[model samples]
Target: MKKRTDQFYLVREDMLSEAMLKTIKAKMLLENGKFNKINEVVKEVDLSRSAFYKYKDGIFPFHTMVKEKIITLSIHLEDRSGALSKLLSLIAQTGANVLTINQTIPLQGRATITLSIETAAMTADVTVLLGKIEELDAVVKVELIGSGA
Candidate 1:
């Protein structure tokens, strides 16, 4: 047996500077397909291209790893024929396994769907999967909410 001890650290979200926030926003825009090119992402986020280059590798979201393995995704999708079907098809094509799925009633013109998936056999990297999901016409927004393997 080994002794155990509790450890903790405090972080203040408000203490983050504007540049850090802009860097994170730029990365999110790229992740969400709101901006395709790096220049466009940096420009839209009002950060210089040099700043983007400088901070991008180190400015990933706190939940980025949640997008990499077993993942919980929240999707806002148009309530239309074959929308969910097509989304699932893409996931299958990527060799990801669906662990669970839940959807809310269509409100207005869209529905909120939560899917938990395992990526043990994912055909490519998570970034590729994210790009594919973002390309789906019926998908309005896709967020990585949580993950557990």
Candidate 2:
């Protein structure tokens, strides 16, 4: 097996208050689609209903903030009808709002398209979205040209 360079560090378990632990559990429950109603979440996590309400709006998973940034993608695709349309549809499905799109004329059956997109509402990580784009039959190459908040 290959050595794993990415590892997770654990914080002292005792450092967290019972309320905090419950809140974390409640959030996880919500993310996993195991629970939706606040009452259900509070009960599942063993948290007082009031405590759950107090902290729920203030806490969020790390990826929530990361997804708020805007990024520009440069894609080289096979010059074929519906190729661009399919790519745009994939972006919409990923919840990325397109800010700008520039496509160069086809040359030797390939074209370069650049898209600047707001990722705030994206349901998945940028890498995952890029991977999906790469898997499309019409896409020849994809690159992240830049990103910003």
Candidate 3:
């Protein structure tokens, strides 16, 4: 049996057809609380109600595109002077906001650091980011403990 899968595409706003753009605008109007009724919003945007209904649930504003995602990582680092600082700098460069950090005291020249990071604005895939961090000199191990989106 063939599996049914949902697919998404990122198209530039200007590339969309006029009717599609109008549909998006109509949705925005209702979402912003500027208009109470669907007919008023559809009329203002010059789109038909049938078209609005066709795309309403399928479209959303670009700014609201990324859903909330969080990743929790467990990293083992060499107990060096600047290991933590270097790790944090790399995360910042990728736009992954560090939400919380907990580090255990070094035992036998190694420490376990737990980091919870928000990935909504991350520039690279989470796995790529983790792999990059893992390649650093002071990093002994990197394990993904949990994630939510």
lDDT of 3 by residue, 1-149 (tens): 96745676668888987888998888778888999999999999889999988877776654355434888899999999999999999999999999999999999999999999999888877767888999999999998877777
- The estimated TM-scores of all candidates read 0.57, 0.57, 0.55
Shift in Å, residue 131, candidate 3: 1.0
lDDT for every model? Answer: 0.83, 0.85, 0.86
In Å, residue 41's CA in model 1 sits off its true spot by 31
Q: What is the lDDT of residue 98 in candidate 1?
A: 91
After superposition, the stretches of candidate 1 with alpha carbons farther than 4 Å from their true spots are: 1-64, 67-69
Residue-by-residue lDDT tens digits, candidate 1, 26-134:
9888888898899888888799988788767765554354455688889999999999999999999999999899999999999999999998788777668778999
Worst 10 residues of 1 by lDDT: 4-13
Rank by lDDT (best first): 3, 2, 1
Task: Please give the TM-score that candidate 1 achieves against the real structure.
Answer: 0.57
Can you write out model 2's per-residue Cα lDDT over 15-132, one digit (the tens) per residue?
7678877887898888889998888889877899888887676555444434647989999999999999999999999998999999899999999999999998888898789999
Q: What lDDT score is found at residue 55 in candidate 2?
A: 68
Instruction: Evaluate residue 55 in candidate 3 and report its C-alpha lDDT on the 0 to 100 scale.
Output: 79
